[model samples]
Target: MTAPRLKVFSGNSNRPLAEEICQHIGMPLGEATVTSFPDGESFVKINENVRGHDVYIIQPTCTPTNQSLMELLIMIDAAKRASAHRITAVMPFYGYARQDRKDQPRVPITAKLVANLLVAAGANRILTMDLHSQQIQGFFDIPVDHLFASPVFFKYLEQFKGDNMVVVSPDVGGMKMAAAYAGILGAQLGMVWKKRTNATTVETVNVVGDVAGKDVLLVDDITETAGTLANAAKIMRDSGALSVRAAVSHALLSPIAYERLALGHIDELITTNSVPVDTRGLPIKVLSIASLMADAIVRINNNESVTSLFKIKGF
Candidate 1:
């Protein structure tokens, strides 16, 4: 059976990653005019005909969150109006995901709201990675291919694992991710108890597991202000950890985050280029997930199972 023609386009947020994905998949990126009007409203026009073609828009709602989100929505709407056979939003980093729940009164579940926005904009499918919470997938009625960056991390961290290594979670919220990394690396698991005094400050209260004389590797889904990672690394070192490192899926480094990491005890901050992050001479190493995303895209285009893309070698 012949497969439908596939086309991919990118928004302004992370065009490099999208282009890299297209390169790995052996396809040229689709042409589109995605710009903003003088009034700050998004304007999108598909340059080429997309009628009956399976169209995918690679737009991660990263920094300048509102602008990126609007661009994606407008592009999806444009694809629909162009009579595309299907429209998939491939978001490498989903913004506003931290607002997935309303633990307090008068708060909105913005994650679910984003999902609704994508659906309303005529997105036929979603391809995203390492959401703040996995349940965000259920927020969408469309088929969602949620890929993980663990395989990429594991592959890179293999050489760094040692005899007395311990995987630590920066906070209780990240215990699940830490456990997964620990299991894959065959290391001990630990956690740091933290209290958020403010949005920008995190106080490390205690260490939950044994880390004395062990090389510590902290894992988390994201890090913006670096408050949690910096604080946890300090406490772990004070508690007798021989070395400290962190592996975060998203490193949306702010000025505050960069300053903190520059002075913090963490020996390294390993992250993925899910968003645009520049180390600028800090102890930060970025691993590429473009290949992972490309493999998933190819499988999705073939209507084939994408489970194997998550597999790590020898584990």
Candidate 2:
């Protein structure tokens, strides 16, 4: 039996990753024209025949987030109008994910808003990776295939696993992720309790677990200013940690992040190409998720189970 025609399209954000995904899936990039009008409005036109085909629009809402998000929405709407059998918004990096809830008064839940917008724009499903919060999955009323970058991290961290290793969380919110890593790697779990003094300043209150003479792995979903990671690394080192390395899914490191990284507080920063992070000779190691996303797209098109993408053995 012939496989149903599967088409993949991309937006201005993270085009290289989309191209890599197409290459991994052994498919040609779909024909689409995305441009902006003289008034800075996004305009999208599907150039190829997509009627009755399963279409996947890969757009990571990274930097220039609002613009990229608009492009994704428009693309999904175009696919739906063109009579695609199904449309999945393959977002490697979901923007506005940090605002998943209303912790403060009069604030908006932008994550939920994004979910509604995607569905309203005719996305039948969503394929994303390492959302800032797991509950962000529940924001969508539609079927959401939330893939993790853990497998990608495990594949790389497997080599560095041994005695005297501990996974550390830079904040209380990340204890769950750190615990998962600790359980998978058979290493100890540690947490750095932090208090935000200001927008960009963080104070490490205390270390919860032992790190004397042990290599530490700090796990986080994203790093913007990197103040938290750098402060945690300093605290870990002061507490006798042999080394402090960070494994984060999204590396949206800013200028200060690079400056802090150069301070030698963090030994290594491992991240994925979920965003265009420039290592630029810093001790940052970037892994690719193109294969992982490619496989997920293939399985979704074939109607196969994607549960095993979350399992890990020996980290």
Candidate 2 lDDT, 223-311, residue by residue in tens: 89999999999999999999889999999888888999999999999999998888979999999999999999999999998987777
Candidate 2's displacement at residue 2, Å, is 6.7
Which residue runs of candidate 2 sit more than 4 Å off their true CA positions?
Answer: 1-3, 313-315
List of clashing residue pairs for candidate 1: none
Measured by TM-score, how close is model 1 to the native structure? 0.98
Best by lDDT: 2
Winning candidate number (TM-score): 1
* TM-scores of all candidate predictions against the true structure: 0.98, 0.97
Instruction: State, as a TM-score between 0 and 1, how close model 2 is to the true structure.
Output: 0.97
C-alpha-based local distance difference test score of model 1: 0.92
Expressed as tens digits, the lDDT of each residue in 189-234 for candidate 1 is: 9988889999999878889999999999999999999999999999
